[model samples]
Target chain A: MSIYLDNGATSYPKPESVYVSIAEYMRNNGASPGRGNYSRAMEADRLVYMTRKALCKLLCVPRPGQIIFTCNATESINMALKGYLKPGDRVLTTSYEHNAVARPLKMLETDREIKIGLIPSTPDGVSDMEWYQQELSKGVRLVVVAHGSNVIGCVTPLDEIVSAAHRHNTPVLVDAAQTAGVYPVDVTSVPVDMLAFTGHKGLLGPTGTGGLYIREGLELSTLKEGGTGGMSLSPFQPSDPPDRYEAGTMNIFGIAGLNAAVQFLLDTGVEVIREHEIELAQFLMDGLDTVPGVTYYGPSSAKDRLGLVSFNLEGQDPNKVAIKLDRDYEIMVRAGIHCAPQAHHLLGTAPGGALRVSLGYFNQREDIERLIDALREITYS
Target chain B: MFLQSINVLDVDLCVQQPDKFVAHTRASADLREIMPYLNSMFRTSTYNHDAGSIKFTNDKIEYTIIGDKINIAKFINRTELHELLDWLKDLVNDTYDSRSEIIPMYVCRKPVPVLFIYNLLPKTNCQQCGEKSCMVFAAQLNKLEIDIEACPILSEPEYTANRRRLEGAFGAFS
Candidate 1:
């Protein structure tokens, strides 16, 4: 039987409820929300609202209306960046961000004449808070940081970072793509200005579903505006938010799946899932240590990092090792940069990336054991 | 658990107010058993024991429950309608749960007759309430089909006593 391990990119074999909800919505309720006041359309409308409500409960957001739906975390990051940043604004970010945050800020740097500064971090991925405090004092309009690095798998010290930025009267936007579903992302406690997340990763929802939570009283420009299912008479878009940010027909299908996924997360507490992932990540990391010619990246302990780990083999291309594990052992894992060049640059693996085996809520010790066995065999081969 | 869902049967543009919407929905339960309880809980409710019907207003939206059907009018949009439905469903379920504790009112609040209302009206076919004529408005008002506030002329100093009489007969004020 083939084993799926590439959960960091997109979770596989989603919770059965997620699949069932999508099919049920598509087969039974195919009507568009806000298109008409018909029963079915109203059902779709409630379905969308319930999705937002579920996400709010899952993410610990106080209001459902503050969460704006997008196609993915990339769109969320783009929206948060493009809408909030004005011309010649200064943005401070982590060195370990995925391209979702990097590319948009780069585009803004060119188009809007904004400036970007990377927070100084230690070799293992912890941010230099002293340097960060000095930078915050120097004044930045916004601070964007990844809650967890997709490349190295280290969980950033968000409390320290967010507290420092807010002290400086600067708002912070978090790209929580990797940490949202697995970690306790309580906006109530931490009070992040904006938090962007994806549905298909730890959230265990279908692709094309994600959202951004904008704190109350914080309004951002619309990334794109069209039919928002309401207020058609006004030629100009409504001043109220999520409608202000969310325009055009939403992906109700994906949202239905996401609703179920978020409900699953709420039912099965993220704390329980966090404990499980930590155990699995530790097992995988500890197992890799036994195999000669294998070297892993990120923190030594699993508790300090995410459920994913990246590593390399001596004198072997990561792509071929990934392919061999897939073809010969029926094991699936991702290889290469994983689309965060800056993270790879930090790890001194700029061009060539490492083998990444990310765990899921459903992953077991047997799966990691089998992966270890495959790697031990490949070490000699 | 007593009221699980609301099945919306028909949705139409509210005639009294064109910009808003009206929905004809059937609750999972007949809600006949809970009407008295609802009548007890809602101060604004007008319960008619003889007709097995109850009408109430919440957040300026009118709800008339007869048998299993609940007609809701003057809602802004589908989202608000759904929220109202959920609110109503919760209210029904909550009232059903504590039903034994609530005292049921078996009395019918009197419905003002149509001609009586027509006599108080300016008797002009004002059509101010978007109705065709005063008689139609009075008939609609008698059925609780439209709010008494729909008639602007009724507010004038010429009809203060009539307006008070109408409000008293309806047991209501917008």
Candidate 2:
């Protein structure tokens, strides 16, 4: 069996319930929510509402109605960035950010003339609090930071970041693509202004499912406007959210899958998953330490980062090594910049990226050992 | 059959149609206890269990019941108004008697599309509802701001078919 170690890109082999939920929704209740007064349509509306409530329980969100569904975390980040930022508004972001945050901010720089400031940090994804605090005093409109770095597998200290930004009366937007399902993200405890998450990743849902949680009273301009199945006569969009931000018929099929997936997370518990990941990550780190010619990036301890690693051989190119592993040993991993050039630049591995073996709930110790065995041969052969 | 009598509380000018009137009535029995039963009975209802209110449309009239206070909107005159109230009193008494047979659903049915209501309008832009156009009247109707009977044009003999359609879609025609 080919090892699937690319949970960072998109999770595969989703929970059976996720697949079943999507198929059931498509086959049985094929109706648009808020579009009609039919019983089936109302059922669809209940499914959506239940999913929102489930997410609120998971994220510790205060308001369920503010959670707006988007195609993916990228769309969510775009909604938060484009909708929240005014022309010429200043934003402070981190050095190791995914293209989701980088690309949109780049476009905003040119189009809206917004000044984008980068906060320096180490490869372990800990922000430079001294510099961050100094900049906060200078006054910025927004702070965008990744809750976890995809390239380095390091988790950022969100508690500190959110509190510092809030002290300055500035709102913080977090990209939780890498950490959401595997970590205990309590929005009530942290009180993040806005958070974007992908349903397909740690959430164990299908692709094309993700959402944004906007704190109560935090209004963002709508990115797109169309029929929300209610209030069709009014030319102006609804001032209240979920409706305000969400327009057009949603992917109820995918949302059905997400609802089941989140329910699974709630049932299994994220703390259980986190403990399992640490065991796998520490095992991989331990095995990698034994092999010669392997230089991995990120924190020394597994507890300090996500269940993934980015490593390079002494003389082998990351792409060739990944191809050899797949062709010869039936192993799969990600190579190249992984769509985060800023992260690669910070690690001094700018152009040629490292091999990324991101672990999933399905991954076991045997999978990591197999990966390690494959790397040992690839190093010598 | 708990609600034996429904006393008229007050009467006022319908906001959407000043020619028409909206009336408020106080039910003898607490109607809040049977809201969920009414919610399950009416498919096109917007029920707020927390607010203890259920708003629904029957025939061409709209009714919003909060606790024991009933706000009935859009009737041609006082004669038809009492007839509507009496119809409601009997309907509630019957529903309460049959509560054990029905499954009470707390989930509110989402709002009906204004466009659907607009399609049922006469499209005459006839300022008969005290509104500039029929579309605005349809929007107000969707929000429960005005009653369906506000558009007197729909009551005309020529528009009987449209009125029947409205009654069929919302509730049973009297």
Candidate 3:
């Protein structure tokens, strides 16, 4: 079996429950939900509804329907960005946004004539809230910030940022692609307009399933108008929480798997999972620091970041190191741009970025040692 | 209603009003079935399917056909673009490949032609992956975004000097 380390991309060896539950759903209650009145269809609807409720409990959203599903966090982000912004509306975002968020905003910058102001993050990937407050003073309509940077894994001050945005009457859109399941996102207490997330990343769901939590009554122009099963009779799309934004048949299998995944998190308890992953990250961080010629990024302490690390070896091409780790060592790691060029640029890993070793709960101390041992050999040789 | 204009095999489909275009679902097979009718709408000559891209110069739109599975067509005028999107959606339902969804064709302005940059050195640079000229290999590599593993020569220590310099020239993380 491949030593899978790309948890930042998608978690592997997903809970057996995830696979079994999806199969169970497809085998027993496979049908277009909300379109039919049959028992199987109702069962499918119940499964989807339970999934939403599970996500709500995980994110602390009071209402379940406010959670809208999409193919991935990128699509959810695109929906939030495109739906909310009107021409000339000023959106304040941080420099640390993923290409998923940055690319859509850039497209809008070029074509839609929307004004984008960036709140530059510090070297450790924390946004300069003073800069954000300054932008808010300049009439910022929406403030989009990542709960954590995917490249460096630095967790931002979400509570403070959300509180600040609320003062300006600007609703913040938190891109929780990295932090959703690993970190506690209590939407009930934290003031945010929307929390865009992916099920595949920390949530441990299959790929091609993700979603957004739009605060009730927040309006967005529907990115795609389609048949949302329930309101098939209407000419215009239904103006409801999920159906308003979620247009089309959902990724049923992926969602069923995701429901199981989220259920796994609840059963295990996120606090325990978070504590374990953080400890593992700390273990790896401490191990990586002892190696000579190794330059790491993100907060020096593991307390400030997520379960991922980005570092580079002296006089080593990240790609070469990645190849060596994969082929010779059987250790899998990501090399090159982690899709957040601006963050790397800020961290001075620009142009040629660092090798990223993102750890998950399933990762053990022995795995960390193997990585450490491999780095020693790769760096020395 | 989620179907939109899809440019397929050199065809502009479902031309309609700006706001009415629908998003195409991956399930739709009808979009893939009308390729013959869609291909007939082409105004260009160089129908090089192997090049992996279809060019529509008059309208400044390029539809890069990613393999036989996915077709991403560009629309220049944002107005009535939905109509074209709708047509494309119909074709996608008809012609889509079974195994893959093919990367969605994103509408972009800059012609980021994947040009390969190689070390312009005359030295044999003969580090083994077999090609006599590193420049030719770079050109071929640039033309096709293949994995660096395919280029056998880069594995050698002799080409080490050129590989470092060459990867820097072609910036998106060599």
Candidate 4:
């Protein structure tokens, strides 16, 4: 089998429970969650509710109702960004955000005349707290930053950023696309106003699964309005939590898969997965250090970043390396700007981009060894 | 010898029109020094400094140069193949003569991948290109399966730069 290393894009070989739950749900109870009151419908509702509960536990969100399911983090972010920002509102974000955050803000900047302040980060991809504080003092309506960069895999200082934003009575929205499952995101402790997460990546769920966690008192207008099973009589959208946000029929199968994946994470513990993934990444980075003509991007050490590394071979296009790796060695890695052009520009790998090797808990040391050997051959052969 | 002989070593065709072909040539000197020159000469060229190779396209013909060996693809006939080789020979000599004036670019000039291209796309996932996502459309573009004109979003003035870059990297719109 090919060695899968594009976990940052979307995790593969999802845990056995994820597949089982998805299949079982499809085979037995394939009813919409809130459409009916039959046994099958009730089962669907229980599944979605349990999925929400699982997410609340994983993300440290206070209430399960606050977890609003979306197609992916992109939709989650769009809901938060488009729903919250009005014309002329000031929004602050970091340089390391994916297009999920960047594109929405870019659109709003033009459509609504919302001012965007980009907080500069260190060379290692950590947000500059002083710059963030300065921006916060200017009284921005909201601050949205990625918890971890998809390109470099570096985790931002979300705690400090959130605390600083709170000091100025500004809300902070965290794009936790990269860190949600791999790292501990204690919303209760961090006081983050909003967080958007995807299930297909670190959470080990199927595709088309992700959600947004809105803080208790904060209200975001609905991005889409349609049939909510309960609010059929009213033409206006509901002013509640989950149903208000989820307009159409939910992706029950995806949520079932996510429920199982979250349970697996809860059972195994996130710290254990984090430690394993970090060890594998460290091994890959250490091996890369010996390869000639190889330049890695992001923080100097693996400890400071997520379980991934981005690098480029001298004179080789990242696509060429990735293609060779797949064709010659049956190894899989992602190569490109990683849907984060701003981040790549910050890492100085624009135009040609860079190759990314993202690690998952299932990745063993042997996988890293094989990757290192392949990279060595590609670089030095 | 300023230029020597070109030979078609092997041709492998999976379908009616061969998607890929391999060839080699004997030259007086190593082609490594002239790679960057070729890269600059071709809009669709990617030069790998570490591997000492350059891949570029002339019209519809894609060429990969390593030392004196050349692998080419997507030729309709022998005449087209010979014409491409002759053009390459001239490019090599011209670049060699003008080496003093030319600055060698060691960076890979490859087209940005589908994801990067997709980022620049409208990303409405509107499926106007007959594909589900803009990412899929970008992938087809990379494979030369489709052209930028197929994307309705490119017609918009807002995406003029993206259209230009795509045209530059892939070649003039088909």
Candidate topping TM-score: 1
**lDDT per residue as tens, model 4, A1-381:** 689999999998899999999999999889987676465765576578778878888988876778899999999999999999999999998887898999999999899999999888765886777777887787799999899889877888777888888889999999999998998889999989999999999999999999999998899988999986653555777677777788898899999999999999999999998988778778888999988888998887778889999999899999999999999999999999888998888888898899999989888999888988888888776
| Model 2 / residue B174 / CA error / Å | 37
TM-score versus the correct structure, for each prediction? 0.80, 0.72, 0.68, 0.68
**Local distance difference test, each candidate:** 0.88, 0.87, 0.72, 0.82
Query: Which structure is stronger by DockQ: 1 or 3?
Result: 1
What TM value does model 2 have? 0.72
Score chain A of each prediction against the true chain A by TM-score and list the results.
Answer: 0.99, 0.99, 0.98, 0.98
**Interface RMSD for all numbered candidates:** 3.5, 15.9, 16.5, 30.8
Off by over 4 Å in 4: B1-174
Calculate DockQ per candidate and list them. Answer: 0.22, 0.03, 0.01, 0.00
**Native contact fraction (fnat) of model 2:** 0.00
Residue A98, candidate 1: how far off, in angstroms? 0.8
In the range B50-149, model 2's lDDT, one tens digit per residue, is 9999988776688999999999987644334555765798999998999999889787876557898899898999897899899999888766667788
Please identify which of the two predictions, 3 or 4, would achieve the higher lDDT against the true structure. 4
Model 3 agreement with the true structure over B4-51: per-residue lDDT tens digits:
423222222324422121221122223323333233344231233334
Pick by TM-score: 2 or 3, better one: 2
Instruction: Report the candidate with higher DockQ, 2 versus 3.
Output: 2
Model 3: CA > 4 A from native: B1-174
- Write the residue-wise lDDT of candidate 3 on A243-334 in tens digits: 77777888889999999999999988888878887888889888988889888888877778888988999888888999999999898999
The sequence of per-residue lDDT tens digits that candidate 2 reaches over residues A236-306 is 77667787888899999999999999999999999999999999999999999877888899998999989
